[model samples]
Each structure stands twice: as C-alpha cells, then as structure tokens.
Target: MKKMSTDNKLISLLRQSYGTSNPQEAATFLSSAIGRVLKMEKEARRAHITEALKGVDLRRDAGGGMNSKPKTVYKDTKATQEKLAKLEATLQEMKAKYHALLNDGPQTAEENTRLKNRIAELQKSIENQKSQHFQELALLRQHSSNVANASELAALQQQLEDFQELSTQLSDECEQHKTRLKTLEATLEDKTAQVARLKKVMAEVAAGDEANETNVHQLELELANAQEALAVARKQNEEYNDKLLATLDSHLAANHEIDELNAKLVAALDFGQVFADEADHWKNAHDQKYADYEELQRRAEQTQTEVQSKYVDEHQRYKAASRKIDSIIEEKDGLHRQITHVRSLLKFEEQKSSDLTRQLSAARLEMTSMTDDLAQEKRVSELYAKNIRELHDQLALLKNRPVLPDWLFSGSMASGICFGLLFSFSADVAPAQRVLLGVCSGAVAFTVARIITKKNHQ
Candidate 1:
C-alpha cells in the first residue's frame, strides 16, 4: 500500500508537471520521477529476492519436512506472484496513462507542429537576440574604446595646451630679451659717443700742450733778445758818458785859460737836455715789454687749469659708463644661463608628455581588444542558447510528447525579457539603439498589460 501510495504521488507529480505544458520542464520532471521509481523498484526487488533465497535455505536445512517444504514453497510462490502482480498492475496503469495521453493524437500532433514552428521561430528570435546582443556588445566595446580614445585625446590636447602656453611664454621672453638687447646696444652707443668725446678732449689737450710748448720756446727767445738789446744800450750809454767827461775836463782847462768861455757853457747845457728826454723814452718802452711777458704767462696758467678740470670730469664719466657696461654684460650672462635652464626643463617636459601619450595609446589599444573579445563571447553564448533550444525541440519530438502550447511558449515575451535583462545587465549600448529598444519594449509591455487589465475588468 505504501508503494502504491508512493506511485500515486509520483503519478500526481508527473501530471502536475505535465499540466504546466512546458515540454522541457515536463521532460525533466518525468525523467527524474522515472529514475526514482526505477531505483525504488530495484531496491524492493533486491530485498524480496534476498528474502526468498533465505527462505529456500531454511527449507533445505529442514531436510524435506512436509511442513517446512510446503510453507517455504508457498511463501516463495506467493511472494513471486505478488511481486509479478504488482509489477503487472503498475505496467497496466502506466500503459493506460500512456494510452490516454495518446488519445488526443490529432490535437497533440497539431500542438507538436505548432510547438516546432514556435521553437523554430523562437530559435530564430533567439538568434536575432544573440545577434542583437552581439551588436550591443560591439557597440559597448566601441563606446569603451571611444571613451579611452577620448581620454587619450584629452591628454594630448592638454599637452598641446601646455606646449602652447610654454611657447607663448617663450615668445614673451624673447621679446623681453630683444628689448634688453636693444637697451644694451643703446648703452653701447652712448659709451661709444662718450669715448669719442673724450678722444676729442684729449686731442684738444694735446694741441694745447703743443701750443704751450711753442709759446714757452718763443718767450725764451724773446727774453734772450731783450737782454741783448739792454746790454747793447748800456754799452752805448757808458761810451757816451766817458766821451762827455773827457770833453768837460778839456772845457774846464780852456775856461781857466780864457775868461771868455761863458758862450760855450750855455751850448753844453742844451745838448744835455736832449740826451735826458731820449733816456726817459727808452725806460718806458722796456717796462711795457716786461708787463706784456707777465700777461702771457698768466693766460697760459688759466688755460692749463681749464684743461685739467675738463680731463678730470671726462675721466670720471668714462669710469662710470664702463661700470654700467660691465653690469649690463653680467646681466646678459645671467639671462643666458636662465634660458639654458628653461630649455632643459622644456626638454624634460616634452619627454614626459611623449611617454604619457605612448602609454595612453597602448591602453586604448588594449581596451579595444578586450571589447572585441567580449563581443565574441556574447556571440558564442547566443549560439549556445540556440543550440540548446534546437536540441530541446528534437528531444520533445523523440519522446513522442506534445510540445508546449503557444500560450506557454513565451518566445516573444522571453525575447523581450532577455533584451531587457541584457540592457539592464550591461551598460554599454549605442544611444539610439538603446533608446529605441527601451521605448519599443516599454510600449509593448504596456499595451499587453493594459489589454489584460481591461479584459479582467470587463
């Protein structure tokens, strides 16, 4: 009875499973139930056989006693009959169920045909789904690749911006350098002008020195001639004085001898008056020459003083300008060193930027490759799903069972559901396609749900 109850429970389970009208589900359920029943039956049979063997052994040990022989034989026969009857009944029940299931042959055939059609349609749909999934994967990969490319592009653009900024700064620096150079050149020109002026001054000083030398020489010659003239005048005056003295002595002797000498004395007084006037004129001329020589010497001293002052001023200015020039040269040298340092920094920056660009490029390439692999995997998964569906259909046909009903097939619904799942699961999709799929699926589900609700309300 317990075995019968268990069989009934299994049958009930089979019926319930079949009622769901899903062939694969039914197959799976039925196969499991069948396996369980077979196992249980085998275990029961094994136990029963073992008991029968033990009974035979006991009968043989009783050594042909009538009671032992009849009891053991009857028990063994009865157990065999019961087991056979139970097996036969179970077989008959299974046959009746199989017959009942086959009674709707035309309907089952039609359902099967429809199921095959639906399966084919579903397979095609699934294939399309797979293709769409592949495309979506490809689109996702493309988006990922594009994102990587955009990142690289942004980096490159940033580098370019940096380069441009550096270039602008360099240009500004160059302008400043040019201005500085011009200023230095102007300073050099001023220095040159100053040098030229100093040279002119020195030339004037030289000319003045030459003039002073000539004046000194001329003055020396004039002094010598004046001294000679003074000596000759003194000599002439001495000789004349000597001759007058002699004439006075002779006149004195003649006066003593002759008292009539008064007329001759008056004539000697007139000649002495003419000689005194000439001597006074010569003394005034000699004093005027001495004053002229003193005036020339004073003028020469003033000229020398003026020349000395000019030389001192010029020397100071030249020294100051030279210092300034040295400072400018030092500044220029410092600027050159700064430029060299800046150039080295720029070179290092350029190398770093180049390395960054290369790394970005490599990363983008890797992303593209990964995306392609993902797309391929999606395609393979789709193919596998299609194959499973085909095999399922073939298996249903082989089992001589009705395929699932159209209402339970769920091809279109499953496709839409899968699309939704895929859309939700993955974030990589083309904008246009994603939007279109979302809208279409949403509309379909909404329409179906609304129709069902309206029908239910009615």
Candidate 2:
C-alpha cells in the first residue's frame, strides 16, 4: 500500500517537474519519466552484474568457498534457457515476416495496378471488336439481299455463312487468348516475384550462417576460458584446504602440550614445572584457528557465487547465438517453398507467351485485310461530300434575289443607331434624355428602311 502511494506521489511530482497538468500532458510526461527510469534501472542492473563479477574474483582470491547447490542451479539455468529459446524463436519469426512484408508490399501493390490497367485495355479492345463485327454482319446481309441469280445467291449465302463462322471462331479464339494471356501474365508475375524474394532470402540465410559461425566460435572460446579459470580456482581451493588441515594439526598439538602441563600440576610436583603463560598462548592459538576456519568458509561461498555468475553470462550469449541460427534456418525453409512456386509460374508464363505470339499473328493478318476496305470507304465518303457541296451551290444560284442590297438591309439599322448616338452627344443632353432621343431616331430610320424594302418586293 505504501509502495503504491509512493508511486502515485512520484508520478505527480514528475508531472509537475515536467510542467504538465492535463491528462494527456501527464501521459507524455509519464512516458518520458518511465523511459528515463528504465534507462537508470538498466544501468543499475549492469552495475550489479559487474559488482557480482568482481565479487567472484574477490572470493577466488580469498580461496574456494562453499558453492551453491550445482544441481539446483543447473535445473534453474536449463529452464531459463528453454524459455529464452522459445521467446527468441518467436521474435525471430516475427522479424522475418515483417521484413518480407516490407520488401514485397509496394511491389505487390504496383503489380496489381498494372494488371488492372491491362484488364481495362483488354475490355475496351473487346468492345471495339464487337461493334466492328456487328457492322460487318449488316453489310454482308445487305449484299446477300441484292443477289439476283439462284446459283450466285447460293454462293454468296455460303460465303456469308463461311465468313460468319470464321468470325465467330476467331472471336471465340481471341477471347480465349485474352483469358489465357491474363492467367499466364498473372502466373508469370507471381513466379518472378517469388524468385526474386527467394533469391534475397537465400542471401540473407548465407549471411546469417556466417554470423552464426562467428557466434559459435566466440562461445567456444569463452567456454574454454571459463573451464581454465574453474581449473585454476579448484587447484587454489585444494591448496588452501591443505593449509587449513595443517593449522588444525598444530592447534591439536598445542592443546596436547597444555594437557601434559595440567597433569604435571595435578601430580603436585609442578608449581615450578608448570608454565601459566604457555597455557594462555595455546588458548589464543585455538581461538585464532577457529577464526581462520570461518574466514575460509566465507571465501569459499564467494568463489562459488562468482563461478555461477560466469556460467550465466556464457549461457546468455549461447542462447542469443542459438536464436539467430534458428531464425536463419526458418528463412531458408520459406525460401525453398518460394522457389518451387516460382518454377511453376515460369512454366505457365512460357505456355502463355506461345499462345500470345499466335494471337498476335492472327491480329496482324486481320488488320492487313481491313486496311484496303477502310481506305475504299473513305474515298466513297469523300466523293459523296463533294457532290453534295456542288448541289448546294447550284440551288443557291437558282434561288430568288433579296429585295434590298446586303448593306442596305443589314447596315441601315446599325448606321442609324450609331449616328443617333453621335447627334445625342453633340446636343449635350442629360444621360436619360439623350438615351431616349437616340432610341427614337434609330427606330424611325429602321421603320422607313423596312417600308421601302417591302414596297420593292411588291
């Protein structure tokens, strides 16, 4: 409860220090504060690890102390490693998928747009072909209706039938060709993309393999060094143990001497023979031996902790290398699948290309046949347009003339209106009055010209 209250107080204090009061502002403040705190925490953890490592050296120098239970430590380390491996595998898989997506996403989108445009063009071409086919069928029908002889009519009908059959067959083939081309193009594109992706992935796999090799070499070196250190520590501890045994023997011998002194005193000849100062010296030596034993025990414990820490550090490094290798292997497997898919697409594209070439040849032949027909039609259309223009001119010359001249009928109203404006300006009249006078004069002049033209027509 106290911890929670203290955390809340800290948050409030941080928010104030960052000059934030609103909830959103506070959130930003909290984020930065937490980030800084995490950085500090990480630094603190690193410091602790270093300190623990240093303590190990200290313990080794002091001599072998009792180690923590090896079996229990091993079990814990194994479990931690297992969890780390699983987590790293998951993380690596996610990274591979994300990288693949980033690489291919834009390319896939661009290919889709290109395919859409091709489809639209295909649709437009098909529509135009359909309209042209209908027009040609109408023309053939008209020609058939005009046939006079039964034999000729039968021949024409047969020809029309053949042409229709050919056209229908050609159209069907064209449609099929288009459909096949679309399928082939799509497959080809798919294969090409897959091949490219696989190639890239394989390269990455190679690079990853090199990285794994390096990591493995590093781990091996570290392991060998650790083994050597352990051996040296063991030898030191053994020597220290031997020295402790020798100290025990000396302490025992001193006690034995004190016992002899006591026995002599008890026998009642030895007030002169017994030494009180020598007894005091033996007691102090026993005390000193016990203190040394305790110190040795403490040093042994520190050395054990140091060895455990070293093992953990090496284990972490090994786990990281294992994770990288696992990721590389997974990518290689994915690349194999992509390569197979690409090969299949390549075959489809080859077949599609062959079909497309045949279709192109047929289109070129049809275009050649249509060329003369279009030119002949254009010439006939031009002849009809020229004749229509001559007929129009003839009719225009044969028509009756107008009663008045072009300028008299067309220009009189314009001239009178313009002169009336000039007269109004010379008289210097008010704007409204001048406008009225100008309109009246122009109206009078137009009425007189119209009367004269009507009389001339009569």
Candidate 3:
C-alpha cells in the first residue's frame, strides 16, 4: 500500500510537471526527461575523466643504466588535452547549431533520428579514444623505469621497441582521423543534397504564389549564405587535414632519426670488437716471435706470388675495361650521327609538307577559276538557244507565205533594166539587145528568189 502511494505521488508530480492530463503522455515525458538527464550525466562524467587525464605526464625515467644512455621519451599530455578540448568545443558548437536548426523550421523525423544516432556514435567514439589513451599512458608508465645493470645494447633495443610501439599508435591515430574525415565529407555531401532539395521545394512553393515571392527570395539568400558558411567550414577541415599530415610526417622523420642512431651504435660496437681481436692477435705474435719466423717467411713468399698473380689479373681486367670503353665511345658517336641524320630527314619532311600545302592552295584557286568559266559557258549556251528559237519562228512564218513577192519582181525588173542600160552605154550596144538582156536578167532573179525561198520552207 505504501509503494502504491509513492507511485501515485510520482505520477501526480509528472502530471504537474508536464501540464498533461493524459497519464500516458505524462509518463512518456517523464521517461524522456530522465533519459536526457542520464545522458547529460554521462557526458559530465566523461568530461571529468578527460580533465583527470590532463594532469598525467608520460615522462621516461632518466636514471643511468649503461655508459651510453638511451634517448629520453617526453610525451606532453597537454597536447592531447588540447585536442580533446577542441573536440568537445566543436561537439558543443554542433549541438548548438542543431538546436538552432530545430527551432528554425520543421525537419523530417528521419533526419532528426539520423542526426541523433550520429551524435551518439560520436560520443561513443570519443569515449573509446579516451579509454585507449588511458591504456597507452598506463603502458608508457609501466615501461618508463630502466634496470640499472642493463647493457647499453639492451637499453637501445628497449628504446627501439618503445619507438616502434609509439609509431604504431600514431599510425592508428592517423587512420582514425582519416576515417573521421571521410565521414565528415559524406555528411557534408548529404547536407548539400538536402539543401538542394530544400531549394527545389522552395522554388515550387514560390511558383504557387506571388505574395510569397519576396519571402522565397529571402530564403534563397539565406541558403546562399549557408552554402558559403559550409564552404568555409570545408576549407577549415582541409586545413586541419593538412596539419595532421604534417604531424605524421614529423613523426616519421623522428623514427628515421632513431633508425640512424641505432645503425651508428651498431657500427661502433662492431668496430670495438674488431679492435679487440686485432690487439689479441698482436699480443700472441710477440710471445711466439722466434717460432713464427719460418712460418712468416713461407707466408711472405706465398703472399708475393699471390700479389704477382693479382697484378697480372688486374692488368688484364684494365685492358678489357679500356676496350669496352672504346667500343662504348664508338657506339655513342654512331648514335650521335644517327640522331643528326634523323634531324636532317625531319627537316626535309617538313619542307616537303610545306610544299604540298602550297600546291593544295594553288589547286583550290584553279578549281574556283574552272567553276567560274563553266558558269560563263552555261550563260553563253542559254543565249545561243534563245537565238535559235527566234530563227525557227521566222522560218515557220516564211513557209506560210508565197515563194516570191509581187513587189519583189517589179523591183528586180527595174534594177536589172537600169544595170543593163548602163552596160549597153558602156559597151555601145543597141536598145533592143539591152532590153532583151534586162528581161532575161529579171527572169533569172525571180527564179533564184523562188528557189531560195522554197529551200528555206523545206
């Protein structure tokens, strides 16, 4: 009965807080509010943990372990803290912007849900990174101390291992950043697509009403400003990427330096070993000087023969190399000559091409002249055809008339008589003979006219 009373009181409190008469709605609001409070508490705890991590310095112990000391490792926790702070600030800014977006206008339920999921994932990733960083710091602290009696080589080995591990961790972090960058790019693309969709919808809406045109235009300007802001953000992300790459490069260079140091140390160790071996050899030789005399003499003779053989071999090799060099020089000269010949050929081909081009131009001009001449001939042919048609019409009219005209006969007779009289006077002929000649000439003229007219008709 007491539990029931307490539940009733809690329900009454939830109803009053939500100002809802419906019990179900009140319960839902209370549940969601409690969830939000729990989430805020988690975030606070994470913040506290990160703050605690900031004070932990991962420094290597500098105690002596050998004659040559290993390089000291100093990793500043402040840089990590700064990065975390920046991330948190960015997250907060995103949350603020998201809240502003929610207040500005209605959004799709799917979009809100997706954004919530993404925020949750980001929080989870940050938590995982924090845990991983804590583990790495613990590992560093664990290995910071060196054994006092350890050899220099052993210390160097340990240092090399530590550097390798650190490089691996850096590589992992770089990969994580790359993945995060890709995710951001994908999110940016989605946002740009969403903006485009919104613009399209606004345009459709604006088309429906002239009264809202001004509002639509204002919205367009706001969208444009948003796009500009997005571009600025993208540019900043690119700058951050460049900075990360530079850091990776620096780490790689440090690793390279470490490798060089290791090589030098190895070389020094080898040289010391060789010096010790040589010293031991000389010391033994001094203790057995007389006993080694014959052995030394035989060894000297053997060395002299070997030297002579080596000298002969070297001379032969020198001769062979000299011959090879001579052959190579001759080959090089031949190649040079070939190259010069090819160049001359290329020049000749170029000249030939120019000549061909000029010929083509001339051919084109000749073709144009030929076409003009053809057109003139066509005009002249047309004129000739017209003249022939006129002549045919005249011939047809002539065929319809008599072969000789009555007027023509009289005119001819008179002209003949006059010509005959002139001939008679000149030759002192009689009037009778002149008249006869005139008559005959007139008759012959009439006959000739008749025949010519008949042929024209035919």
Candidate 4:
C-alpha cells in the first residue's frame, strides 16, 4: 500500500511539474528530471575530485608539512581508546539526528536552531578526530627509529580505516545537502522575481483603472453639463412658445378690429352712393344744391384714400409677423437637433464606461490566473526538490551496498580450479605444457568472471 501510494504521488508530481496528462509523457518527464539530477551529481563529483587534486597539489608544493610524516605513534591506551570510541559514537548519533531532520522536510525555527547546533557539534567532532590523527602521526614520526609492533600497526590501520569511512559518509551527506540547498535557493530567487513582476503588473493595472475612473468622472460631468444645457434650452423654448402665443392673440384682436372697420367702410360707401344720387337729383331739380354736392363728393374721395392707406399698413404688419413666426420655428428645430446630438454623446460615454468596466473585470481575472500559475509553479519546484532529495537518498543506499557479491568471488575461484584441472590433468601432458595450460586456463577464468560481473551490473 505504501509503495502504491508513493507511485501515485510520483505520477501526480510528474503531471504537475511537466504539465502532461499522458502517462507516457509523464514518464518521459520523470526520466528527464532524474537525468538532470544524475548530471548534477556527476558534475559535483567531478568538482570534488578537482578540488581534492588541487588540495593534494597545494600540500605537495608546501613540502615541509608534507615531508614531515607525523609518526608520533600515540599508544592507543585503553582510556584514550574508550574516549575515542565515545566521541565516535557521539558523532554517529549527531549524524543520525541530522539525517532524520533532513528527511522530515521543513522545520520550525527551534528545530532549525537544533539542526545548526548539531552541525556545529559534528564539525567540532571532525576537527577533534583530525587533531587526534595528526597527533598520532606526529608521535609515529617522532618514534620512527624504533620498529612498531605488528599489533599496534594493525590497530592504527583499523582506526585509520574507520576514520576514512566516517569521513566519506559525512562528505557524501554534505554534498547532498549542498545540492538541495542550491536547488532551494534557486527556486526562491525565481519565486521572488515572479512576485516582483506580478506586483509591477498589478501596479500598472491599478494605474489604468485610475485613468479609466477619471475619464468616467469627466464624462459624467460633461453629461450633467449637457443635461443642464438641455434644460435651459427647453426653458427658452417654452418662453418663445408663450411669446408666440401672445403675438398670435394680439394679431387675432387686430384682425377682429380690421373686420369691424371693413364693415363700417362698406356702410359708408353705400351711404355715399345714396347721397351722390340724391345730390344729382337735387341738382336737376334746383341749381342752388350743386355747390353742396361738390363739397360732399370731395369729402368722400379723402375718406377713400385714408382707408386704402390703413389697409396697406395692416398688410405690411401681417407679413412681418409671419416672418417672425417662421424664424421662431426654425430656432425651435435647431434646439431639437442639439438635444438629439447631446443624447447620442451621452449614450456613447455610457457605452465607453461599460467597456472599461468589462476590461477591468478581465484584468482582474488575468491577475487571478497569473497568481494561480505562480502558486502551481512554486508547488512544482518544491516537489522537484523533494524528488531530488529522494534520488540522493537512493543513491546513498546504492553507494553503501557492495558492488561485487560474495557468491561471485567463491564461484570464480571454483571455476578457475575446475578450468586448470580440465586443461592440465591429462596423463600424457608434459610438465612444461601443463604449466602453460594452467596459466591459459586461469586467464580464461578471470576473463569470464569479469564478463559475468559486467553483464550482471548492466
């Protein structure tokens, strides 16, 4: 069940890290990630070798210390030996704790402090070990005139081997930790850059929103101004309408007065005609009435001229009123057109405001999507880091295991003995020929063993 869960987790990580839904593609991505880690490990190993070579070269060049092989054979007395063992045990415990902390993933501040303290203790232990080795070397050099006992040499050799083994383990662990730290630091830098970019984009978006808001406010102010202008235009129109109505009422009154005057003029013309006929009759009957008839005809001619002049003046006044009404109507039409144009402008501004609002919403959505993408990338980076750590753990396990099996060694020896017997055991074979045959047999056996080992490793 745990293995299945681990596989499923790895599969999920592959999909998320590489953005691949296909199993094959995800596998490919997993292979690539593993390959990258292997490449990094190879590079790190190469760098370590180069640094070690450089250190050796430096030590060789600095000859005094290199020449003085510290040979002060510090007798591994029981008490000193026990202290060494205790220190070694302490270092082992510290190392185990450190590895446990690393495997536990992220740690709290207190845990981090403990981890640092553990690391310091480990360093101090290593330094102590180094100093003790140096002291032993010095003692051995100082006592070089005397031949050392075999048992003492063997014990010193064993101690040196133990120290080398511990150093190798610590070095490997340190390299793995350094690689992980580098990976995490790189990830952190990338996340920081992304956050900065996002912040800059958000700032730009805010500026755009502010500008859009300002435009909207200005448009609203213009719309209010237009509305006020429209209201004023309407008020003026109403006043013009009232004035026009009043002018029409006065024109109607004038027309009524003109009609009454026309009736009076018609009555006067009839009366004059009757009077003219009476004058003619009187002139025919009596000559004394002729002078009075002449006077009455002159008065009638003057009254006709005055009435014609009054009619002409009234006709001119009516034409002027008609022109004024036409001008007023034209002005009213112009006002209506102005109102329509203002309405169109208002609608356009409203549409613009709505468009800006939609743009703002889209920008917000884009920002949200960007944030999600950054979060996903951060998660993928963390998973990749975890995978690297796991790979390192696996590599460490592989390194600890023996490359060549014990069974292979035994089998190779048995096969070599058998091959020698087959080649040199014939009754008729010469001694010299048997020696040659045995050598050939042994060479063949060794070659076969090598081939088998290589194939098994592959």
Candidate number with greatest TM-score: 2
Error of 1 at 420 (Å): 68
lDDT of 4 by residue, 1-458 (tens): 97555444444443433443344544565674455435445775464334433422221233444343333323789999999999999999989976764465444678646744664465456446645665676456445512333344445455555555555555555555555555555555555555555555556655655665565565556555555655555565556556556655655655565555555556656788766655454434443333434444455445445544544555554455555545545654654565455455545545555555555555555555555554555555556556555555654554454445434544564466456656665555543344445545645765687688778776
Error of 3 at 362 (Å): 2.0
Better of 1 and 4 by TM-score: 4
The regions of model 4 sitting more than 4 angstroms off are 1-320, 323-327, 336-340, 343-383, 402-423, 426-458
- What candidate 1 gets wrong by more than 4 Å, as runs, is 1-290, 391-458
Q: List the residue pairs that clash in candidate 2.
A: 64-300, 65-300, 65-301, 66-300, 66-301
Query: Each candidate: RMSD to true structure?
Result: 33.4, 48.6, 65.4, 32.6
Best by lDDT: 2
User: What's the C-alpha lDDT at position 282 in model 1?
Assistant: 46
- Regions of model 3 farther than 4 Å from truth: 1-297, 395-458
Worst 10 residues of 3 by lDDT: 144-153
**Model 4 deviation from native, Cα RMSD in Å:** 32.6
Per residue, candidate 2 scores C-alpha lDDT tens digits across 1-458 of: 97555445445545443342244444555565556456446675464334433422221222332232222211457889999999999999989976765464323556656754664465346445644664676456444533423444455455555555555565566566666656656665665666566566656666765676676566667656666666666666666666556655755665576566556445534554466565556556656655765666566566556655655665665566566556655665665565566556655655665565566566555555554444554455455455545545544543433323444533555456557767876985544344456556655776787799778766
Q: What is the per-residue lDDT of model 1 for residues 1-458, given as tens digits with 9 covering 90 to 100?
A: 98777666666545544443344554666676666557666777465334333422221222333232121111457889999999999999988976775563333557646754665575567556755665677567666655755565555555555555555555555555555555555555555555555555556655655665565565555555555555555565555555455555554554453333333334445677765555455445544544654554465455445554545555554555555546555654655565555555555555555555555555555545555554555555556556555555644444453222233223444556556646843875433344345446644754575466446645
Q: Estimate each model's TM-score.
A: 0.25, 0.31, 0.23, 0.28
- lDDT scores of the candidates, listed in order: 0.53, 0.56, 0.53, 0.53
Per-residue lDDT of model 3, residues 1-458, tens digit only: 97555444444444433454344554565674455335445775465334433534434234442223333323659989899999999999989976764465444778657754664465456446645664676455434422222343354455555555555555555555555555555555555555555555545444543434454455555555555655555565556556545655654565565455556556656788765555555445543543444455555556556555555555555555556556655655655565565555545555555555555555555545544554554555455455555545544554454433344444554465556656765885543454456556655765675577557758
